[model samples]
Each structure stands twice: as C-alpha cells, then as structure tokens.
Target: MQTAVLSSRSLRIALPLAAALTLVACAPMSTMYSQDSLPDAVKVPAGNKVVLQTVGVGEILYECRAKKDMPGQFEWTFVGPDAVLKDRSGMQVGRYYGPPATWESSDGSKVTGAQVAVAPAGTGNIPHQLVKANPATGMGAMTQTTYIQRVATKSGVAPADRCDMGSAGAKQKVGYQADYIFWKAS
Candidate 1:
C-alpha cells in the first residue's frame, strides 16, 4: 500500500492551525464573572476581580407600618434578612444577616458593607445590589474582600399582605434566593 504524504503547501497551513489550537487548549480557564451584561448601576468597579461566589438562601423580614410622612397609610417596611451562604458545591461556607448587613464565613471571618448602588432585577424580585466592603473583622476568606454583589434574585420582595392600620405591627417573612459574588482588588 502506498503511504499518503502531506504536500509542503498543506504542511504550512496545517502546522499553524494545529499550533493555534494547542495554545488555546493550554490557556488557563477563567470561570470568573464577566459583569458586562449587568446593569451599569450594579456592576463592580474596575481593578477588582472575583474571589468567591456563594448562593444566599434566606428570608427577608418586613413589618407592616405606617407609611413615612403619610398619616393613616400603612405599608410593608423592610426589617432585615437572614440567609445561609453556600458555595457552588452546596457546602455551607457562611451566613448573611443583619440590620447592618453582614457576611460571615465559617472560619469566623466577617464583613459588613455599605450599599453602593442597586438596579431592578425584575418584577416580583428584589433589586440586584452592589456594596463596598468595610475592612474585614477577622483573618480568613473575607479578609481581602473589597466588594460584594447581590444578583440572581428570586422573590424577596415586600409582602403583599393587607397593610392597613389593622395589620400594623405585623411581621412577615418572605423566602428568597440570590447569588452573592465577592471581589477583591486585583
């Protein structure tokens, strides 16, 4: 049987194509978030890169109260949130809760942040949010956190229960789920 051989013309084209494919395959893969499609208001600032990503499964508490500056009008007012933070692997790594909004790791490192901006997620969903992290409280996973983003919101909106004077002082807990992406300065 005669052996087939590649012509010099074919070798020139095939070699470069094969080399390009090899380079691409060997390149480091980045699973990091590309916040490009997110709304500008909720996008993290430049010079930062994703450090950790966790899902927050939780509830938001709301209390029926008189609408501020509107006598006799009542509505549901935000109380706070309580959530369990889990990594993509479904392991519990931390928690999120508070009047001041804290994120704490299982290692005991914790952080609180100030809201930077928020953008509408959708109808019947809480807004996506960006926060600027405060200095961490312990040495661990959260120590270098510079920003946190709340995204992929499900539910977590204000309770739709009757909130007239009759319902005043009543509290409601609404279940919610969201992804919290943590970032650090690159």
Candidate 2:
C-alpha cells in the first residue's frame, strides 16, 4: 500500500514536470527585436542627406537640411531610450533632465544634418522569448525582453533660398536604416 502511494505521488509529479518540459521546448522563439525588411533607398527619403550609422536594432541613420537664408545654426537635442539628451556627434550630451526635445536651424551657410536612434529591443513588429533549461533536471522556462537604447534627431540649412522653417524643403527627404539584434546583457 505504501509503495502504491509513493508510485502515485511520483507519477503525479513526473507527469506535470514532463508536460512543463515539453511545453517549454515547444514554446516559440521571442521576437523582441529583429531586422528591418525595408531597403536603404526606401528607408531614406529622396533628398535628405546621410549621416552616422549604428550596428543594432532600431538604429536610425539619416540627414536633414534647412531652408535658404536661414539665420541661426542648426541646434537640436535628442532623447535616447534612457530619456537623455544626445549630441549630434553621437555622444551622450547631457543627463536626463525631462522629456527630451531638440531645436535646429540654419546658420547662414548651407549645411546638412543626420541622426540615428537605437530602438529598444522588443519594439519590433514581432515579439520574442528566451528559453532557459536545466540539464540536470530537464526542466525549462522562457522569458521575453527588449534591447533597444536611444533616440536621435538632426537639422541643417535648407537647400533653397527663401527661409521656410515649417517646410520640409523642396522635395528634400531623409534616409534611415534600422538594424536589429539580440544583444546579450553585459
């Protein structure tokens, strides 16, 4: 009778453990971040200039220009994923003060601009999960996470003559590239 009871208890535990292991093994892969399918030309618009490029998911690379005869230089700020201001040279400009913002314009000469924003993982169109297992026990589990980290912006003098701050500029467009990756936390 005691043996029967032990057998039953073991079966109960083993059945559930087996089911869990199977479920975890069958779980779909996580998709928090992935590569973008859009082409380079399509990603960047027609007239916008090119700028810096990054090597992670949601990374943005593009340029901007100001209208003709604009007065001051292009001045703008970027809010990275951590919600901090980043410099145009791709350096962390300042600490997180508040909701990030940027302001830019022409400085009398014709100039171009560019920017790149590294999107946090898990912001992709599809979702992803991580699977972990214990070889000794044959038990497993899965978790989902994201890995993106920045936001960016750029501004410059427009290619035209008459200064028009509101205008996107005559047929001017910017190009962008978003790269995706599953980065391991350091």
Top TM-score: which candidate number? Answer: 1
Q: Can you tell me which runs of candidate 1 are displaced by over 4 Å?
A: 1-31
Alpha carbon lDDT of residue 78, candidate 2? 22
Against the unseen true structure, what C-alpha lDDT does each candidate score? 0.91, 0.28
- lDDT for each residue of candidate 1 in 1-186, tens digit (9 for 90 to 100): 123345666788999999998777554333477898789999988999998888999999999999999999999998999999988767788999998899999999999999999999999999999999999999998999999999999999998889999989999999999999999999
Model 2, range 1-186, lDDT digits (tens) per residue? 999999999999999999998776555434343234432322332332222122222221212335237564332212222222233333332222112211111111111112333222233221121212112111111011112222222321123333244532334322222221212223
Please give each candidate's TM-score: 0.82, 0.20
For model 1, the local distance difference test gives: 0.91
Instruction: Tell me the deviation in Å of residue 136 in model 2.
Output: 40
